[model samples]
Target: MPAADWWRSAVIYQVYPRSFLDSNGDGVGDLPGITAKLDYIASLGVDIVWISPFFTSPMKDFGYDVADYCDVDPLFGTLADFDALVARAHALGLKIMIDQVLSHSADNHPWFVESRASRDNPKSDWYVWAAQQADGTPPNNWLSVFGGSAWQWDARRGQYYLHNFLTSQPDLNFHQPAVQQAHLDNLRFWLERGVDGFRLDACNFHFHDRELRNNPPAALRDSTMVSSVNPYGMQAHIHDKTQPENVAFLRRIRVLLDEYQAIAIGEIGADDSLAVMGEYTTGGDKLHMAYSFNLLTSEFSAAHIRTQVEQFEARVADGWASWSVGNHDSVRVMTRWGGATPSPELAKVVLAMQLALKGTPCLYQGDELALTEADLPFEALQDPYGITFWPEFKGRDGCRTPMPWQGASAHAGFSSATPWLPVPPEHAARAVDQQAAADSPLSFARNILAWRRGVAQLGQGDIVFFDAPEPVLAFRRDLAGAPSLLAAFNLGGAALQFDWPQAAGATPLDGHGLPGAAEGAGVSLPAYGGWFALV
Candidate 1:
């Protein structure tokens, strides 16, 4: 793939920095720790490595609250450590995409501190500040994604400020020209430092309603982005976010990225995320691609998966999508999609299905081992989101637990010291060292990825889904002047025998190691099995 369009169908491996590895035994993963694993990441045959935020922050919302956009947090190491990481990743032919949380900054950041200092300060309008209502209530009915009211009263300003998340992470005022320019400069800083691109966090939240209109009650609750228990889902979120002004700002970001030949994939959460995704990426003057929580939710079925892709394709003109089955924010796919008794076979099937889709595929860390979500005691929980929601909604700590490298080592070889989060013994059982067998999910992931490289249609072709039964997902990848590729996945546990008329007379393709066979129009698939052929 050419460097310019390399990200078009690239497979991205997300490395949550805090749990990837601990180099100096600090009980936390760092830049150097990631640097030490570049060769391993390259071995997966993935094209990009997206590292979550490690910026200067107090870690209130972990690293999402940025205090210094231009510096690495001491917990992760210094600027030199980041430079070395970039060098190592580039040497391994892997592009580095760091998280850019421009929508908000830590309240302690110099800009936010100064902005909240006094109403007459030079930076007073840098953040979203609003006046209190006549009855001493908040300006509007917008609620925080974390919980409670989105407005927090600032004593110094005698007014309220908007925070779509935690109060400490105050939303920036994109209406301010200076704020826009400042973020652009920050992007330039990293691009100059040899970083490949960025994963724009909450990209749609960059702009909000200027009039401060009250958001109406949601016609239907939206649990895709937040827990159903969260009141954040109760509102339609029309005025508070997904503003029209965000498009121009995205255009500016694209212009900046073009100058450096860098790419950007945005994270979108909205009332209509699919539509917003299409709007932002269609013109090609905005984000290169975008992903929503539609596939990341607890809903798992052949219909659910097919609908998301079809809906996104319908809305986009020429936009692309980065479909991910797992990420840091949600329960592990093996647990969420899999039943009480999850199977490694399901993990292999999920990987095959995600790769076969007509878009970029993003794989989360430790998922190759088919690691299930870790169950942590409430007292041991560190995530504030989970703590607030309590037993009803256990936060993301389950998925953010330390990666298990060795089954027999301390903390599963993730750290010499005690890890920030305890590694589950169940996860240790499926650690990288233990899953070295050819039949392991890790080995299957490698084989499938290597096989995908040789199939041009899988990488760059139009997708068409066949109407099959509930447990079976059948699709064909069509490329001009070449035989079409037919793929069918059995998402259920029971072995199945189905007839796919479209797959008649298709030639079976090998190299991808999965147990499935087809005879004319009849296909036989084992539990969580997949079949591939050239039709």
Candidate 2:
């Protein structure tokens, strides 16, 4: 692959800034802490390091609510600290990508403050503001993902403003060309800082229907399709988000990125995610790639995985995709898919399956150590979403806990001082120091990642899923001029046997370090096992 096409099949490691490492003894991870750990990140064999939002914010929704676009938050560190971190990551051959939350800004932002001062202010149209109906209700029936009505009434302007998340996060008005230009200038600010790319947060929510039309009710509701805890998914979401005008704004963003040879991956959360992903990334003039919450759901089965990948492939033409099973928002894959207890075999199988699939793979931090969600009490939770809907939903704090580096140290060596969130004992048992031992999941992940780096067919190939039994998933990856590779996995906990006539004359690839996998004329796989061979 050409140097310019690096992100096509690159393995990007996500670094949630608050939990990665704490170097300032402030019980929170900072930019300098990440700079100090570049060597360990490089050891994972990933091509890029995508850091979650660390921009200036009020911590309402962590760093997602941006108070300032051009500067770093004092809690995270100074702009100089960010520059040093980027310098160190580049020195270690790891490209850096920052999170860009372009959809909204914190209410405390200067623009929002000025916009709300009065309806006739210079920045009055900078945000989504509307007049109430005769009944004194909001303009529409839009709902916030965090909960309740999406509109918030502001007496200063005598109008309600839209907030798809917390009321503190006011949705920006993309209809205004000045708003779009200002955001593009912010992107240039980062590009000038030598950043390689950006992970667009809520990319589909950038625009809303100018008519302020109410979203139609959804026909059905399922936990797999949308969040069961929040009512935001109960709507068809036609007018509130994923507007047609978003494409033009994306093209403008692409033009700016092209000047710096940078790339962008969008996060699409909508009623029809696969179709939106196809539209957002097609024609190579919008986002370089896009990923949705399809694979992040709790559905873990051979048939489910096959359907998701195949449906995307069928719809997407000339567009690219970036796949991830876990990230900062969703529950960790181990507990969500691997059951309540941690399974080393299950972890290894999932790692291999994600890497073998076509597209760039993003591995969340501490997933290589097979970390599970931390069960936190209601009082211990910090997330506003969790606090709003407790007992039924505990929020994202479970997966956002500090990364455990040392098993025998206080707070799992995340910080000597009291950490923001308590480190679970179960997580400490699977710490980096403990998993460095031979045959551990950490060791298996290291071997699999290194092995994937050598196989072009696994990363940069077209995937075709073969018809296999319920418990087994088999796929063939074919790359131009490269030997095709066949990969199979047993997703169930019971031993399974699969008959594959295509395995004739195929050579088994060893040293992948996957456990309980054996192949012969056909194949024999133990519980939670995998097999890879050159066909």
Q: Cα lDDT for residue 271, model 1?
A: 92
Candidate 2 local lDDT, 239-286, one digit each (tens): 998999999999999999999999999998878888999999999899
**TM-score of each predicted structure versus truth:** 0.99, 0.98
- Cα lDDT tens digits, model 1, 6-62, are 787689999999999999998999999999988888988999999999999999989
Tell me how far the alpha carbon of residue 482 in candidate 2 is from the true structure, in angstroms, after superposition: 1.9
Question: Model 2 TM-score?
Answer: 0.98
List candidate 1 stretches off by more than 4 Å: 1-3
lDDT of each: 0.93, 0.89
Cα RMSD to the true fold for all candidates:
0.9, 1.2
